[model samples]
Target: MGLGTGQGLHYETAERLSAALASRTICSVELVESLLGRARTIDGKLRAFIALDGADALRQAVESDRRRERGAALGPLDGVAVSIKDNMSVRRWPMSCGSRMLDGYVSPYDCHVVERLRAAGAIIFGRTNMDEFAMGSSTENSAFFGTANPWDLGRVPGGSSGGSACAVAAGLAPLALGTDTGGSVRQPAAFCAAVGLKPTYGRVSRYGVTAFASSLDQVGPMGRSVWDVAALLGAIAGLDRRDSTSSPLAVPDYTVALGRERRWKIAVPREVFSDGLDGDVRDGLRRAVDFFAGAGCEILDVSMPAMDISIGAYYITATAEAFSNLSRFDGIRYGHRSKVAGTVGEVYAKSRGEGFGAEVKRRIMLGAFVLSGGYHEAYYGRAQRARVHISNGFGEIFRNCDFIATPTAPTVPFPVGAKTQDPLAMYLSDIYTVSVNLVGLPAISVCCGFSPQGLPMGLQLIAKPFHEEELLAAAAFFERNHDFCRRHPKIDQ
Candidate 1:
């Protein structure tokens, strides 16, 4: 139960591990063993990973060590153990996306991000659990199992990247990759009190990530510190021929932005903060604003009226896309097929019904309704127009400000199953974050403060498209003044 051999390495940030590996002071094999050992002991109750290929991870570690000894190490991530969300494919690993549909399916190829990590010599540690097909806000929708918050085991880790956040927060790994489709990465990061960055849509390639709202889905990085997050982002971000949406712009050296000071024009979206925000989160936002103002940054009140329609617009658009993307899972191509079905039609219908969880089914039905012939223009078309208005509003605001600041979520980590029976309540958890995805802007969540009950709250900073450097720099400035990221949750005590 104790950290065992991996005690010293458990809380080390990805940046620290990379340095240790590069200097030969610590080998990748040792670090991988320590982490794998810890995961074996702690992950049982946390339910963070759906798959942990320790043997393969150690083999990768040994290879990294050998390369380091030969002075041929790939890069900064050479020896770091990186946890991957179950939705991102890692060759030969199970990529269930916490769904029964792809339950036993092994990926034949690595995702674009995974390919980058492998090339960087990172030890592809494990596949973390997620909401089924990334449909739910809380991990309770995971068809297999739910991941618990490390700070409070009885509470839910926000999702659909709950397991990825829990892995980093619980010290199973110092770095992780999560997909953000309407706050999946940032919300969980906020709940777990970690740093998470969702890059500008198309900034990072999304070739092999299992589709979920294709237009909004993006691979992101999560870590214990701003530097670690920036580093991970740098490693995996670049142009990929396979992903048509990937930007051709050069990937900046994100680490250079760390520890730098610059006077920033920060916009506070008044509409977002006016109501429905929890007192603790509001307090955290106030403190964050005060800190930035004290640091000589200018804070201006701004308006994004269309943002008021973000939640409704996002669900409509995302669900419609999900419905289209998920149709391929119907027994014919790959994934779970119902044996009870005697005919092709029955196979398609029964397999999907049996394979999908409640949340997934609900979204699919809603999506079908919205995309139906008569309602398509009324619902889907309206949502698309709303998305354009929201994007334009963000565009106008960003032209004046360096970044936009707001609370990451309306509330802190909630008790597991508390909102499971009520989907609307669960959806509201991402009220503040959905807009960024809808607009294709870059955003990050950093721990701003904690509630009286000790749950963490996050301050979100959003930047213009392809401006992750500016976003990460601003987050690092705040991280420099706070120790929230340095402190690990005292779970199992």
Candidate 2:
């Protein structure tokens, strides 16, 4: 039996585990059994998952075995179990987005990605925890649950995709799915020491993922390796008719097209590498570029004049959209209703006040204020113009570079609650990642180094919209040729 057919199936990437199945070293039944066991036992400390569907997982695993025996067409990820963020809807499964407002809501149909994963023979083991309505930078805003960092239970995993990141990093699953709005996926991936991808907006369908910001949300994979992310991306991505926003381009064969799939020109914006980046993070970035350069790739220094405004502009646009998107959650419709309220308005006010956590309410109020008549021009409108400035700046840079690379974060994950009281401080943590969302580009964060505190730091890769293949190729080259991803905190370390 392979190592994966064991009592604990954590820390292995989906690609690695799937390869074991193809070789017939382990059966799908054994793998899912062990993986599912972890969800029942190990998940209690991590709080990564909100619900588990053991019967469904077993059903899928058995079906995969029957298919293999019959020599039927098996997808690349046949029978691998993965957790979906609570915000993503899967048929008959709870899709609460980590709030009391949706305590018992179940999706009537699968989201585009869910259908693809099921078609590919993957099993949905459970729904993972997340920020309420995908609204905050930490899982602390989840009204029903909190996801702790797998590395240290006291620290956060990051959010609103923290649940997915924790599941992947903690070995609750080989891979998981998450949505990135602002830096939701990347930030949490960095904090949890996992690999996370944010597809170019429209690269993946948003037809069923609970909407926080219509224009910025994208569904991407969370895993332990570059290829795991790429393979999952290959299965779930491409155009979708259900979502008018999905891109019309053909999905590239990312796994086959990786690693210098033709000579490449990678870029590093010197400004992004400037001061305030921790020493270890700076060194990691330097080493990542040098490794690629040595492998016959061009590493160029590029600049964008408006990157300075990306974080601020992103807040304006995302918050405004969030305000509008969240209004649909009134108690009368789909969410939790206030028990003590008599009038409908009181029901709404009481439900909203009690159902939402501090961060969700803060953003909703801030968003409402910005979109209000008097504040629109100075706040919302100015942010939109700044977005144009940032977008044009990225367009100009892409003219000279095939892709951009930077440390996924400016620093390692700080202690949980380190910035909870200060929203501005927390927002600043996304300085490097929010710009990618603003430009509607595909980007990824892979574990690149451990901080002095022994937590992880992620190195980020950015590619043009619909160019995810190029981004992961660079990441694969980096992963295979270096010791960057070989270290993680261990009990004996």
Best candidate per lDDT, number? 1
lDDT of residue 352 for candidate 1: 95
Tens-digit per-residue lDDT, 126-242, candidate 1: 889899988787798998888999989999999999999999999999999999999999999999999999999998999999898989999999999999999899999999999
Q: Please count the clashing residue pairs in each candidate, in the order shown.
A: 0, 1
Q: Each candidate: RMSD to true structure?
A: 2.0, 2.0
Q: How does model 2 score by TM-score?
A: 0.95
Candidate 2, 97-186: lDDT as tens digits: 888877668789999999999889887778888988887777888887778887777787888899999888877888899989888899
* lDDT agreement with native, every candidate: 0.90, 0.82
Model 2 poorest ten-residue lDDT run: 484-493
Q: Residue 307 in candidate 2 has what lDDT?
A: 67
The TM-scores of all predictions, comma-separated, are 0.98, 0.95
How close to the true structure is residue 252 of candidate 2, measured as C-alpha lDDT?
Answer: 78
lDDT, candidate 1, equals: 0.90
